[model samples]
Target: MTKLSLNRRHLLKAAAIGSVALASPAYLRRAHASGGEVNIWTYNNFVPESFKKQFEADTGIKVNVRLVDDQGKQFNLLAAEQPNPTVDIMTVAGHRFLQFIDSDLLAPLDTGRLKNWGNINPTFSESDWSTIKGNKWGAPILSGMEVLSYNTDYVSAEEARTWDTLFSEKYANQTAYIIQDMMSIIMLKMGYDGNMVAYLDKPEEAARIVEEAKQFLIKHKPLVRKYYDGGAEIQQMFVNQDIVLGHSWNGPAAALINDGFPLDMTIPKEGSYGFVYTYNIAKNAPNADNAYIFLDAILSSPEIGAAMTKASGYISTYKDASNHLTDLEKKSTSFTDEELASLQFFRAEANKMKYGLIDPAVEAIKAA
Candidate 1:
């Protein structure tokens, strides 16, 4: 598997850029683009610079991107700037798409205009997260799955491909919880049968389920060597040999293996948790025409999708894009049919309630 090369300069550039201070001139200038531009608010480096240039060349519309780390902040900025909003295009995780839809922040999509919409993986296009309330508010653009990632030098592929390994005595104190969010671990403890999002549809039942999920984490606390608050720490721990097996997203796992860390991710037999970042046109975008044109050009073209995947570790939502990716890129970003059957994603609105309930529950568990 060939790994996409990452240079020190790129890493530094990514780390140095943070969210433009809210309401600053830079933020204001970017939030509102001229008629000739399509203002976009997305994660740093989520869109490939090369693709943006190509889109600009094909069409007269100039692409303006603003980097932000927090998806919640996207809504905050939009809400503050409403009635005369600046951002024309917004990209958010699939799980959080509903929040914007519920708040009336997104424009109803005309999928017929997106020529390559059909090329997107059915798993994404058909997902409730992609199409809510009978309207498509966002297009799934990037993907990453929460799979069992471990240092291969320490754990064999067979041993790492099961949820049971996380609780086993063999790797006890050698396992780590790298993800800050507890939803993945909570879902695993729930046996992957209960829908975390179901809490929204059936609150009474979900409330009880939430309690059980928290207790499950407390029970497994002894098995964890450390509970990391971020991905970088988790990667550092794995590199230092502090942990043999831990939970990880596919993108980071791919980067680690490529860095020669002897690490890899496995879709556990018990299943996996994954997420997709979707592209949505703002409800009051100034250049809605250009936004659709840009979306179609980027999301519909396999080559363009491949460029984004290559530039960022995240996978493309369009499945045909896999044809343009190398073996390692496919292995890192794309999942097989069997893996897809086992993967589950949460509903953003329902998950908001879950996060609210789980946060304090986790605190109490850790305190105990």
Candidate 2:
């Protein structure tokens, strides 16, 4: 795979620049002759600089991107903007779209307007997350998952194949994971059938499973060197040899492997969680025509999809995006058909209970 030089610092710097751009009123007012500007709210590095410049050059639609890392913060900002939102486009996770839909913050996507809509992989576009109640609400763009990542120099492929490796006595004090993710995966490991959402309506059962996971985490707390926060922190831990085994997002793990680190990640035998990130038009977008133009430009081109995958270390939902990837990049980021079949995607309708149960359980585990 071609090594991408971007690290967390570079991403943060980009986000800082985007934030400054969003804060400037004059920047938002600038218009082009061919098409008006499209204001987007998305994660840093989700839309690479190269793609943005090329899109602008091709369409004459100036792209104004505002970066927000936290999904909760993004939702609140969009909600606060009300019926007249400054953002024309925004990125949201598949499982989290229901709340936005419930609040009527998203506009129904008219797929007929997007000629390249067929380029999207059915795994995403056909899923319940995007096609809600017979209406298309978002365009699936990229996907990411939590996986067991380990340094190959110190950990064997055999050991990395299961979630149990994280708690092995031999690797104690050399393991790390983000708390909430670890807890959720633990619930999966405990025979929830990879369907935690099934318990959302059954509050008593949900609480029981969450409590069990919380206890398990508390027992294993001593094995973990740290409950890291972001992708960058886990990547740094691997680089410094502070962790031999970690629960990490596939994106960060892929970045380390591509950069020549002796690291590998796997979807453990017990299974893992996956979430799709999507692009959606904000309700009442001022430049709706420009928004559709921007979406078409990205969806139709495999080159843009490949660039997005490389820039973010996430899998592109564009079906042909892989054609542009290096063999090594494909191996690191793209999943095999069997692997894809085995994944349990997060459910959109269950966020309320999922977080209500998992969040407090995680806090209690941390306190323990």
Candidate 3:
């Protein structure tokens, strides 16, 4: 297991934080073919190790987690393997949820059985991601937002608030932004925000908007140290002083800040980009019955939901969970009503064809 997959801190915390008083399962739900091991596919960094163990202890089933090396690659792989899916539980971003439904790759989710179903926040739990194909591809647990993160030892929040600071000569070689999922976000500065209801629905128009973002970023590149895909690498760079300011997610930034490293999650003037890492069940999964158990454990149990977010970086979308998180999780976790109100997430489906498909425009921006 990778460092990310094996995280035990949150589970240790969950046990202490959550009142584990529920009656033990009266009887394991009758499995379709008898419950066995469940397979989970997601990136290594975010899956909490504690979640897997506690869940296993409760249900007497094993979770075989597969690491998804790249987001884009994983999406295509699932789309192609629709009929003969391998993994049982998939933790994917919301935008990708729409794609999964489009490909007819999933089974309808029955959240009614989940114990934690009532704990999830309405914003994250709503039927938004439950698509037209009738399969609710993902059940969102946490919402993540990206903002300009800066090392407070060197830069000030006020200084990093505007886009101009990145373009300024002073911060040159000291700034960075994300590449894969933030084109529409940057376009917000150009007055072309991601109203997926409008922009994502029109690919050509989204492409034009992306072009403008490229123009801004290409010039901003000289001032930037690098472009990033969300991971430990960005935080490593910040800690080492390789870059002073970055476009990064809430968890890492907050983690660094709470660890006493000089870090700040700067909310830029134009707003921020957002996404939710949600739980989905794979069709033809090897252990889907167990998968359902795992999903319910997370969605319905406030204790599990809260502890899951405490361990993982993203904010838990469950509204009813008890929070036993560290001060950092309390401060930065995005799932709460207060945090949601403060956030400005981008719309899904709108810029998807243009940004979601990795068309020429997105590649051009990356290559540039």
Worst 10 residues of 2 by lDDT: 19-28
- Report the CA-based lDDT of candidate 2 relative to the real structure: 0.80
Candidate 3 lDDT (Cα, whole model)? 0.64
The per-prediction tally of clashing pairs is 1, 0, 14
Q: What is candidate 1's CA lDDT for residue 138?
A: 83
TM-score of 1: 0.76
| lDDT-best of 1 and 2 | 2
Strongest candidate by lDDT: 2
lDDT of each: 0.70, 0.80, 0.64
Model 2 alpha-carbon drift over 4 Å, by segment: 1-36, 335-341
Q: Count residue pairs with overlapping backbones in model 2.
A: 0
What is the per-residue lDDT of model 1 for residues 1-368, given as tens digits with 9 covering 90 to 100?
22334444544344223111111122223433324889999865567766666456555578889986557678889878875789988987888777787788889999998876887888888876677788988888878777788777778888876778877888999988742355555565566334465447777776677777767777778888987654555666776677888887676566565455577887877776678888888888988888887777676556666666665567777777778767766666666687688776655656567656666776777786
RMSD per candidate (Å) reads 7.1, 5.8, 5.2
Count backbone overlaps in model 1.
1
* Cα TM-score per model: 0.76, 0.85, 0.82
Q: For candidate 3, report its TM-score.
A: 0.82
